[model samples]
Structure formats: structure tokens, C-alpha cells
Target: MKVPFSPPFIDQDVINEVLSTLESGWITSGPKVKALEEEVCKLTSVSHTVCVNSWTSGAILVLKWFGVKEGDEVIVPAYTYSATALAVIHCGATPVMVDINEDFTVDTSKIEQAITNKTKVIMPVDIAGWPCDYDAINELVNAPSRIKVFNPESEKQKQLGRILVISDAAHSIGATYKGLQSGNLTDITIFSFHAVKNITTAEGGAICLNLPESFNNDEEYKLMKLFTLNGQNKDAFTKSQAGGWKYDILFAGLKVNMPDICAAIGLAQIRKYNDLLLVERERVARRYQNFFSQYSFFQLPILEDKERKSCFHLYALRINSISEEKRDLIIESVTKTGVSVNVHFIPMPMLTVFKDRGYKIEDFPIAYDNYSREISLPIYPQLTDDEVDYICTAILTSYKKVIQSND
Candidate 1:
């Protein structure tokens, strides 16, 4: 009856794949990584795809690729992980935090208000695996000129009037909104292959390039490759060529390339990944919804009327009719039953770094409110039907014990 949240669903196939990769004697960012990247491109319909060590590296690399420098601001949702905001800071850019819609995707309405001149990138996080209003976002990001800066003599000297749209598709790797996949919906997208994700590469990610018309994909991808590989103009494979070892350093780049060992696992996962993994996840989610839908305390997730199919990475249960104290009590109760639960995120501004940056919690009431009452239960491909039932019953029992007492 013990159910752990998001235990990776690795089978013998994934294990055998990695073991064979070890035996192959070519491990560091080689053919396997390229094959996986090509597979990702085929799945997501992205022009170019680059593999990195983690989702955080993919996100920051996107900003770095587009030349997001000091004094620039990148728009982000206040509800996402610290890595999302921290990545912006890594690029010497300020994270312009925005609120989310009631359904938890980034609020499109609030974006215009936050965009001033220094805004270099508008990063819309696909929170809880549901994509945002991309059409609306695109219209705003494309319309008119709005690139204000600190000094009139800055990177405006480099690229002008061209703000980028980056999608944090970490949770929505297999998700689609309005029939378009998450990666293709935005200008650039980053997908996570962390242990807990739907498709895991142990700890890895892919940066999918869908750049604007002005930038050439070849040039952009070349820079992306150089940036991830110690800023060298030539990678190790190229340098190993007979009498072809000469190259130059473009910028002080970050070493965040994905290894072939991780890619091997992803390759196996991607091969038979469709329908089988997603269908099981949906079935589990539906069963959880059916069990909890009748209760006043339970507000099941909406997939925006079936036009959008969430990857169902999580089913975020919210006790909105209760206090934060009661929410904590519920978590404790769930824990006592040998079933583990998790919170998807804590609002970034509440963290020490954002607090030091003068970000107040009250600014993003929706995100804070959502975080307080939310609890994400185990919804992986490995959970058995009986186990799901046990977990659901445990949740209902906890809700009754904690919330009824408070009521």
C-alpha cells in the first residue's frame, strides 16, 4: 500500500540500453545524444534540438544564446521553480515575475503590464503540464516595438526591437494545446528528462530551437553547440580529426552537454513512448478524478475542454475551502499513511533571493494561494490500480480528519 510520489518507471529495456552504451566505449556527448536530439526534433517538430545536462541548463542556455545580458528583464511566472528565475539571473538579466490564470497557466493578460523596454525574453512556463494561451502571447510579443533599456547605449547596440519567446516545457514534453505540441507553440522550448519526468534520461534535457525569421537556425545552433561545449569553436569529435584540431573560443561558455549514457536511456524511452505511457497516466488521473470529483474540498484538474491534453504529470489537489494550517496537517496525515505527496512549487518571491530583490509575496496572490493548498499525489506509470485506490482512500481519509475538525 506504500506509494511514493513520482518513482521513475525504468524497465529492463532502459537498463539494458544504458549497459550497452557503457560497453560501446563512446560515452560523452556523441552519436547517441545526436540520435535522441533528432528523435526529439521529429516528435516536437522543432527546427533544431540540443541536449544538455538538465532542464535548468537548457533554459539558461536559451537566454544566453539570444544574448540576454545585464540590465535586461525576462518575463516569468511567479509560480514556477527557483531554477526558472535563477536561470535569468545566471544570464545577468532580471526576472520580471508575472501571475498565473486560475487554471494555473501563465496569465496572458498580466504579461503586457509587466513588459517595459528592458524585457528581452518572455518565458511562459507550461505549469502542471498545461500549455498557456500561446496565440495571445505571440500576438503581444510580435506587435509593435517595446525594447526600453537602462542606458540608451546598451545591447540595443547589438540586436534591436526583437524580444524572444521562450517556453519552459519541462512538464509538458508530451502535452499539446489547441492541436499544436508544446515545443512548436513557442519561439524556443526546453524539455526536461529528469528522473521524475514522463520520459527520463536520468538527469537531462533538450533545447529545441524555433527561432524567429531574423536569426538563421544554422548560426543559432552552432552557437548553442559551442556555448554548451566550453565555448570552443570545435567540439571534441571535430578536434579529434587528423590535422583538423584548430578552433577559436567565441565566449566564456557553460559546460552543460548531455552524455551518451543518459541519451541511451532516453532513446529507449522515446522509441516506444507514445500511447503506452500517456494512456496509463491518463487512466490513473481519471480514476483519481472520479474518486475525488464529488467532494467539495476536491477540485479536479481541467484539461481546457479536451482541445488541450495535459501530460498529467501531476494531479494537484487543492483544499481551497480550508486554512494553510489545515493544508499542512493534511500533508502530515498523508505522510503518516506511508503514501508520499509533494507540492509542485513554492512561489519564487517567497524565497530568500527574490526577497532580497525586493519582490513581495503579496504581488502574486494567485500563485501564493495556489501553492498553499496544493498537494500532488503519486501519478506515475508504475502505480498499480489497487495502489491508486489505496492512495485515494488515504487522501479522502486525511481530508475528512483534518478539514472536518477545522470545519
Candidate 2:
């Protein structure tokens, strides 16, 4: 039997909930969507949450709402999906990519080097469901302005707003970092509820406003609400009101609203989250650690190490002391044995767009080394013990064949 990689764990509960929503007919950003947003609010302990169709849109919208525009620079990690940097570009801002630590987190030491007078935001991605060092990032944001920032191109002179810490926490939804939820760890946190993510909303995302006391997220929320729906003053809720059909165009906001269907799926998922889903994932992670503990050729994903707890999103195993070519061959071998797998990223600088933008792969050596031989194994709540065993067996058998062949 073939074992596919991560898939949604839908049950009768999820099906019934979705059907109930379908039958309700008050769908498409209605009461049900509002309830889901509230549920997210409680879960993250954040004051405000704006649900969107995807994490990319959430990230982009946050930057745009914060007035991140042309001539502004945002810092992003090199060892992340292209979406992390692409969203910054969507806001017409420059993405200064930084290298990652040995654990594949955005290296805190390197972040300071990329800051300029043009730097307005620091977009730190929770790579592999682990939070980047928030305290270090906050310190950088609070440091006395010392980066001799100069502006030559702007006629209207742009000033940096201290630093906005944007957390691209696509993989981490139920994750906790330093006794705080992932959503509450930064200025703005964007979560992915995609099929592959820990929390599956099918194809959706949420923007958490965990701002300081000075920043009132409610006003920003209204703007974002208007922004997502064609820059109109009224959303579907207001338009549905009696004699409130007419609305005015505020700003040219993009269409990125999440429907009740998507929210229904998310609502269903969150119901059993603390009761069952997170526990199961945690168990599976421990099992993987136990199984791979003795393997010298393997360096498992750093989930719980040196003060960090991952959401266990991806079982990224590093091919210790192996060439990238051999790693490819090993992955191919595993695939032949009825197990499905993939890689997390390809280091943005190596991508065509990033390379063309004058970023060199050599600039991020640590990120390159980490990416060269990492294979993301199947990880999801639905994965069973038998399936896990088969996956592990296939991996070990492939490793023996490849390593022995090389020896």
C-alpha cells in the first residue's frame, strides 16, 4: 500500500459541521465566519484577528495596512518558502534576506547587519514551526537608532517607524514559544491553515494583531476589512442590511476574504484541537525521535532543543555528512518504496527571481548547507503507527543502500 504525505484529518465531526454551515445558507463571511474569528481570538489570546483566504494575503495585507510601500525595506529569512519574501515584494518593498542558524531559524546575529534607514519591518518566519528568538528581535527593534539611515530617492522623505516585527508563523498555530502562543509573540502574526499546515482550514489564513498598548488594532481592522473587499466601506454583512446596499469605495483593496466554507473547516478543526489533535501530533513526534535516536546518518528536525518547542509540522531529517546529490538519490529511493516525501525549501537566493535581484546563494552559506540535504517526511494527525513504521523502514532501507553503495 502506498503511503501519501500529509493530508487533512477530516472526520464525521468536520463533515457534519460543514454540512450544517452549508445548510445554514448564511454563508460567505457571515455569522459563522465571525464566530470562527472569535474562536481564533480566544485561542491566540490576541485582541484582534482578521481572517483571510491564505497566509500570503495575510502577510501582504499587514504590510500594506502598515503603509509599507516603495523605498521601504523588510528583512526576511533566506531559509524559508519563497512566499515569505514574495509577500514583501507584493507590498512594493525590498526583502533583505538573512541567513539561518544551525537549527534553520533566522539567525538573530545576522538580522542586524541587513537593517538600513529604509528598513521598516522585520518579517521573521517560524521556520519548521519553531519561533525565531522574539526577545532578540524585540531588542533590535528597541535599540537606540544607530544605523546612520539616509534617504536619497524620496521627494517626500520616508522615516522608519522604529521597527515592526511581523511574524510569518505559517507552520505554527498551536505552537508556544517561551510560555507565549505563537500568535502573541510578535507585533503581527500570520497563520496558515492550509492542508499541509498543522491546522487545516483547507486553504485559509488568519492575521493576529498582538500589538503593543500604543497600537490600536481595531482601527487597522476596519481598514483591512475595507481593504480586502475592493476598498469598499461596507462588507457583505453591511451590504445585506435593509436599505444599506449602497456603499462607497474607500481604497482599492484586494479581494482576499475567507468564506464560511473555509471557516467551517477551521471551526471544526479547532474544536478538537486541545482535546485530541495536538496530543496526537506530539506523540508522533516523540515516536520519530525515539526511532531515529540511534541513527548516526540522521539529524532529525530540531524541535525541542536549547529552549524551543516546535508544532511538529515537518519531520525534516538532515542527511548528516552527505552530498546533496546522494540526498536526492536517497529521496528517490524512499519514493520507490511506497512512501511520499518532499523538501521544505530551496533557499530563495537560489531561485530565479531572487538571484536576478542581485542576491547570491553564497551570501547565505548556512541556509544553503541546511537546505542541501533535508527531506521533509510525512507528518500529520492522520498518520498511523503502521504507516509510520513503514515510512521509517523505507527510510532506513534507502539510507543503507545509498550509503553502502557510496562506501
Candidate 3:
């Protein structure tokens, strides 16, 4: 069996939705986008949500919305996808990289030391659909000493009164933290619906707004709608209406709005989320854990606990104490068996851009340790029970072969 890494769970219902949207003749950011935003709001229990072209766009939008620009600093984990830091760079702000804990989430304890007067945003990534310790991270951001260090710029920044916490929740949509969903866990959260994500809009994302009391979610939502549409005061659907043709460009903004076609896919996924996608993923993850727990070589991903629940996006299996070279060989072995696997991320500092910027991987030992030995298995909703078994057996065989040859 050829087991592939994450694939989008697209069904006839999703196809029908997209077809309906296409037939309706409003393919741009229209009613379907609005409907998808509403569904996300309900799923996350957040007051407002704005669908964007992608998670990268959503992150940059939030940073730009808060006026995080040149001279500002944003704290992000070195263990995450580059999008988390690239957003800061897009704003001409400095991204101060921090290390992560064993669970692959940001280390809350190390966050404070990264804070400076220039810090404006604290972006904690929810890697592999697992929510981070938001309460601890939020407390750190609001700590009196940390607040004293924040130098506000825009009115939104001043209103927030302290460093803003935004979750890079690209992999985590249905995941929960302290009985709250991923988006609600932080001041602002971005969810990706990329092809490989648990839910797919082909290439899309949403911004869940949970800012402090000083900010109005409704107004924020409207402003973000404008931000995503090239600052156009009205959308295509609105202008198509009677006497709505007259509109104006509010200001220069990014054209990152999600089209109705992509939103149609998201609408279908969110509706069947609990009933199908989330449950199937959990079953696959549990099965992997059951099979791998007996092996000394396998270090299982943190599946779930009392304080949190993962959406079971990726089963990031780690090879304990393995060097980077052996890990690569193991991956090669798995591929030789016709089973595809991948790394969750390469530590940001190891990348050429960050490395050239003077960041070092040695400073993030924990993140590097996690990255070097990690392999993400296929855990999409459509993987049959037979395929799951084949994937597990293939990995176990490959791992044993690699270890034996090394010895």
C-alpha cells in the first residue's frame, strides 16, 4: 500500500457546494465567504472571523491591523513554519525567535526573556494541531513587568495596553485548550485550510478575533474585510446590489480575500467537522499510539490530555535519541517502502534567511532536538483501516532495518 502524507478530505458535499457557488455567478468574496466566516465563528465561539487567502495573509493582516511595523518586535518560536516569522518580516518588524518545549509548542517560560520594549506581538504557534499553554503565555504577556516594557504605537496597540498574543493555529482548528477552542485561546488566532490541513479550502485561512474589551469585534471585523479586499469599501456582491455601485477605496490594503469557491469547501468541512473529520483522525492517531507504545525506538506525539485536545492533524512520531543523519536515512527507508513521510518543520534558525540574519540553531537546542528526529505520518480523514495498518507496519519494519544496519 502506498500511504501518502496528509491529503485533503474532499467529498461530494464539498464539490456540490463549490458547484453551487460557481453557478450562482458570484465567485469572488461573496455570500459564501461570509457564510464560511460565520461557520468558523460558531466553531471557535469567537465573536468574529475573517476569511483570508491563506494563514500567512491572516497573520500579516493582524500585525498590520495593530500597526506592527519598523522598529517593533514580535516574539515567535523557532520551531514553527517560517510563515510565523515571515509575517513579522513583512511588517519590517524584528522577529525574536524563542525555543519550544518537548510537546512542540512554544516554551512559555522562555517567552518573557525574549520580550523587549520594542515587542508588540507574541505569536505562539500551535504546531501539529496541538494547542499551546495559552493561559501561561497570556499571563506572561500581561505581566506587569512585561506591560511596562511594551511601547505602543497605533490606537489599537494603546488600547490593548500590553503585548498582543496571536496564535499561529494553522494546524489546529477544532483543537481545544482549557475547554476553549484554539481560536478563542488567544487574543487573535489564524487557522489554515491548506490542502494538507484537516480542513481544506485548497489554499485559505481565517482570522478569529478575540481581542480585549477595549476593542470592538464588529468594527474590527469590518476593517479586516476592507484590509483583505485591497481597501475597497465594498465587495463585488455588495456592488452588484441595487444602488450599491457607488463605492470608494478606503486606503491601500492587501488583496488577500478568500474567494467564494474556496469558502465553499470550508463551509462543507466545518459542518461535518465533529461528525467525520475530527473523529477519524483521532482513531488513526490512537491506533498509531497503541502500536508504537511497545517500541523503545518510537517516541509518540502528545495526542491529548485533560487540559487540552488536539485536532489530530499530524502524527509526529519521533525516533528517540536518533541523530539527524539516521533520521534522514529512516525517512529514506520509509520512502523506499512506498510510504511517504515528512518533517513538521525545519527550525527557523536553520533556514538560510534566518541563519543569514545571525540566528543560530545552537541557541534553540530543544527545537533542533525535536526537529532532527521527527517524522510526520499520514493521518488524513480518508485513510482506511487497512491503509493505517500498512503504514504502521511499514514504518516499524523500516525503523528496525535502519537501526540494525547502523549497529
- Best candidate, lDDT-wise? 3
lDDT, residue 380, candidate 2: 78
Residues forming the 10-long window of minimal summed lDDT in candidate 2: 151-160
The C-alpha lDDT values of all candidates are 0.84, 0.84, 0.91
Candidate 2 lDDT score relative to the true structure: 0.84
Which lDDT value does model 3 have at 389? 88
For residues 1-407, what per-residue lDDT tens digits would candidate 3 score against the true structure? 67778777878999999999989988988889989999999999999999999999999999999999999999999999999999899999999999999999999878888888998999999889989999999889888988887898898999999999999999999999889988898889999999888888999999999988898899999999999988999988889999999999998899999999999998999999988889999999999999999898889988889998899988999999799999999899999888889998999999999999999999999999999999999998888888888889888888888889999
Clashes of 3: 0
What's model 3's lDDT at 273? 96
Q: Candidate 1, which segments miss by more than 4 Å at Cα?
A: 145-160, 241-247, 304-306
Clashing pairs in 3: none
Name the lDDT value of residue 290 in candidate 2: 81
Give each model a TM-score: 0.94, 0.95, 0.99
lDDT of 3 at 307: 95
Model 3 C-alpha lDDT versus the unseen true structure: 0.91
Model 3 CA deviation exceeding 4 Å by range: none
- lDDT sort, best first: 3, 1, 2
Instruction: Choose the strongest candidate by TM-score.
Output: 3
